[model samples]
Target: MNAQPLLEVRDLHLSVRAPNGNRAPVLRGVDLSLARGQVLGLVGESGGGKTMVGKAILGVLPDGARVERGSILFDGKDVLAMPGSARRMLSGKSMSMILQNPMTALNPVMRIEDQITDVLRLHMRMDKAAARERALEMLDAVQIRDPRRVLRQYPHELSGGMCQRVVIAIAFACNPALIVADEPTTALDVTVQHQVLRLIRDLQMKSQTCVLFVTHDLGVVAKVCDAVSVIFAGRIIESGPVREVFEAPRHRYTRALLEAAPRYDRPETALHPISPALREELTQEIVHTYRIPGHAV
Candidate 1:
């Protein structure tokens, strides 16, 4: 690991306003660090506050959600403390995000070329012609054939895989220092998933870009991650290099995840869910540890 990481989230706490005038805690004291030129996998079950961590980092928390405490530091600068104008400038320039759903993330009314070129023009200050050329180059880099044709089309006209490729193009277009890839391949088929994963890895290697790869799939984590963090009940229970954690997971929750995941090599292996008792115990511990005053857990 590098002595200085490209991105770091320390003691992060977030809450969402419920329908009945209540705030429910989502993330509790979550800490993560991504070293420069490395992919750090955040593996956990769904609804475990994994996606919220990424949103918090980008300062894009959803409606009724707010950051209660903690700091998001990118390149040793405190993003949480930055002024609104400065933070807006920092987004998509020094830091960018590849959302899970490409079509929803993109504008339905805009053409693909216009969408991509907008980023280049806004951040790089390139002229329209130059931005268009670079956008085409990026599409080609992501292995999109007939880049000209695709550029003219909207998100609805392209396949899910192609849309994902375009999203990746936009994310890497500016060569941002850090990328938050929140399950970018979850919607694609196995073949497309493989290709997208390969594209991300190749781009990261070529540019030395740091990535926070968020997913529940352990198999994908093993394939592309340099280091892995196991998040359970909004807490990071265990984290280390991929090989070390996979071979010898310290936390029982981590071991449970590995046991539950389907393995192609072990065709007859039975999948076992983590014990309910253990899950309840962990949940209670989190509730107890992060209990806020005047707020029900």
Candidate 2:
């Protein structure tokens, strides 16, 4: 492992404007680090601010969202402090994202070739013919059959799995240093999800690209991630190596999550859902720690 991490997020505090025009804290002092060639899984329940961490790193936070404090350092440079042009230049070429839904991530009307080639042309500075050829190669790299034909087709013409493959291809097209994959397999079926996970792991290994995999699935994290961070109520309560955390989780919430997740090996075991008391306790802890007025965890 590299001594210096490829990406580092330190004490990130974020707030989003609520309907009443008040800023509600979304991410409360999030700290994360991903070394080179590592896959770090951000695991948490929905709305726990997992996706916001990725968005903050990508500089693509939605309207009304603001990062109030802390810095995101990528390759020793603070991305949060970078100029707009520098950040924009670094985003597509040095870093990229594989979004949750491929259908929505891709343009509906654009042909596959154009979508893939556009990134290459813009970031890699490839000419038309070179970009087109590279696009075909990328499609093939993602194991898409009949790359030439698929390139001519629109996103709607492809299966969900195929569309995801295309998105993965685009994400890896520039050989980016880091990729923030936010629930990339949530929209796919079990078999396809397995395939996609394997594909991502394989590509990450081949290119040695660091990845921040954001997902709610512990099973997925076990299979794909080297390290895992458990987020709750806008805070990372527990984080460590996958085997260590899974076998001996330190936090109550981490243990509760593990118990709640279905285990194929223990089919007869009863599922234990997280209790409301625990949720309330964690929320109270957050409130006490931050002392943010009117903040809803």
lDDT of 1 by residue, 1-297 (tens): 568988889988889998898999888889998888999999999989999998888878899998888898988998999998899888759888888889888899999999999999999999999999999999999999999999999999999999999999999999898899999899889999999999999999999999999999998898899999999877889989999998999988899999988876677999998888988898998888876677768
The residue pairs in collision within model 1 are none
- Each prediction's TM-score versus the true structure: 0.96, 0.96
Name the top TM-score candidate: 2
RMSD of each: 1.5, 1.6
How well does candidate 2 match the true structure in TM-score terms? 0.96
Write one digit per residue (lDDT tens) for candidate 2, span 1-297.
458999988988899999998788988888898988899999999989999999999989999999888899999899999999999899868999999899999999999999999999999999999999999988888999999999999999999999999999999999999999999999999999999999999999999999999999999999999999999878889989999999999999999999999886778999999898998999888856963545653
Off by over 4 Å in 1: none
lDDT of 2: 0.92
lDDT of each: 0.91, 0.92
Total residue pair clashes for candidate 1: 0
